[model samples]
Target: MISMQIRRLTMLLFVFVFAGCASQKSIVADKRLEEKIDQNFSDAAAQYKGMMRRLPADRFPKTYYAQTDKFQTGASSDWCSGFYPGTLLYLYEQTKDQSLLLESERILKVLEKEKNNKTTHDLGFMMYCSFGNAERIQPKPAFKDILLTSARSLASRFNPKVGCIKSWDKVKSYHGGEWSYPVIIDNMMNLELLFYASKVTGDSSFRNMAISHARKTAQNHVRPDYSSYHVVNYDPETGAVKSRETHQGFSDNSTWSRGEAWGIYGFTMVYRESGEKSFLKTAEGMADFFLAHLPKDTIPDWDFNVNQSGYTPQWKYDPSKFAEIPKDASAAAVAASALIELSQYTNKKQSKKYLKAAEDILWALSSPKYKAATGENGNFILKHSTGSVPAYSEIDVPLTYADYYFVEAMKRYKELKK
Candidate 1:
């Protein structure tokens, strides 16, 4: 009996030890994952250095396409203008390189005029991305003033009649009709700037506007499956939704990948700012819809609702041929960054799942299949990001925003590891 009891105790000890090992294994960083993250940052630094050498000192890079590896420049008013400096700040944060900081400051000086410009709804992209990151890294009173001014400029676009910020000043509808007031899902991202402004200035107006816009978007822009419409037109008189359509997606009914990414990122940000459970639930739902439809490699095609059975790259114009569609690395990067932040705010089970999904995407993007080698892909970090498939714009190219979010995601991942 004594021998039997001793044997039973030994068996129990073995089981407990094995279980503990398994649990620890699940949380520990894999050697391969660590190597991939390090390599990605190293490659990114090299690529940005090459970009700095190639790009004209006066212009900001927008995108790169085709076999020639040519860099495209955009105006200061362009929605993507902030990404150039924002990306530089991200790199500077990692490397502490003074040259990168100087370059970003030069660009920021040029972008300062947009703080008062009211022609567009992209002040967040233009001001916050640049100035916000600047303040985070090196605080300056001037950056805060610029950010506050930008928030006021953005607030001017908010029409109480529509209950949402107007996206386009003018709309030329493809359906041969005029849209009175248009709100795109992408506008959800701009609310971050307002939330920040409210916090710093002790102004409830900015916060109220952000909450109202979010609630309105949550009511109309999101579908039952958590997919988002690209644009929702509202009546200027009654604040009623007039029509739902997609200008940059496969069709009016299809789900645009970048738009969906914007929803996920925006809602996740909303939850962060407000600590609202509803916002968290909304973000999780959209994240689930996005993850459920991802390709095997974890990156998404330009439009998730597109029928792959009889689709082609030329189908947008030809309508008769089958062509392979391109993946949107920009969307993947944005989603990955959002998921990393979302993981931090959730319970343990969900935190693990979200973090794992983000890690998978980062690993996939780090692979040669998507990560551009140094001096390649027009000196961009990642390749094959689709901007707008239906509009035939920036299709299958390297975009500046892709690099920005990729760097941001890697930064967030590193912080979590620490």
Candidate 2:
């Protein structure tokens, strides 16, 4: 790990240099919508504070089902462990609530041990979301140490032969088939941690691994339309492509909304970090593809091809139930946050298009259609996120990460307007 002083300097340099250059002067803010966004943040502050009060000491919030009034908790090892604290940090950043900060700090101490966890590739989702934001807001030597260690742990999952990070080791009977050396599109999101490792430690190994992984995913995981497959199994021994499948989407060929969102965000971030024109173009293609597929309300179904003619779901749903298919606000939240950053990397015309798409999403999320009531949703802010539809789990629920990225997008929106 690099020294904390050097790491801090590196982070500062990255923020100044790679942060996008979209001109926000022409970006006009809608007063009524702005007020609504403010209220959403304010409500999120209270909702999370109330949640922290009721939360178990050792558990992290995952998803909440309002219909059943069931608030679910996951262990510290769960991929979602970071979003609770991450959301708290965002709320605290906007509201300056001591309660939020104290809660976030409390969770971070428990979550710090995962810095050494090597079993999962979600350290970015689990560590960077919490510790990354923590370091940004309240930089500390300990935070730096934790982040670097987490980066190392995440790097351990990369198999050089595969040219990508392994998403799941092997799984049998998972979503109707077996997977070996699977490299899901979601894995692209984890590359940010590797980039951070290289930037601070000045180690090209981490950067090279990240570049290789990004290139491989951009080449294989995308369809002709730039829509992403949920999973792409690879040959670990020869670095050859085996098959592409979907674990969470409607079908193997269908586009899972969150998976596509991850690619868009990941490529945009990779572009920012590496200054690779190819990654930027890839991100722009992905953003355009995702935007072109949005529903009338700008939210996305759990999978984009759920009802398309050529795509059939792995699980059978009644034909009458087609209209009731759950939408994924989590996907929207993630994509909106990414689009805000992606906007900075483009020309004025394309920037406006990306920003407009993001604005539409943010506006919809702030409305009653997707935003939860102030104190409802078990103190969770947004509702209607589909976690894993094929698993029949957390469908149409309020997810912690959804709340994390919603506020994150709102924060970016506020800053962009300023």
Best by TM-score: 1
Per-residue CA lDDT of model 2 for 236-256, tens digit only, reads 899888888878888888889
Candidate 2: Cα lDDT at 182: 87
lDDT of 1 by residue, 210-321 (tens): 8889888988989888988888999988999989888777777778888898998999999999888988888988988899889999999989967655433322454333
Give the Cα-based TM-score of candidate 2 against the true structure.
0.91
Off by over 4 Å in 2: 1-29, 173-177, 315-323
TM-score of each: 0.93, 0.91
Candidate 1 residue pairs that clash: 312-323
The positional error of residue 182 in candidate 2, measured at the CA in angstroms, is 0.5
Q: Which candidate wins on lDDT?
A: 2
For all candidates, the clash counts are 1, 0
Every candidate's lDDT: 0.87, 0.88
Worst 10 residues of 2 by lDDT: 19-28
Off by over 4 Å in 1: 1-17, 20-31, 308-322
Residue 408 error, candidate 2, Å: 0.8
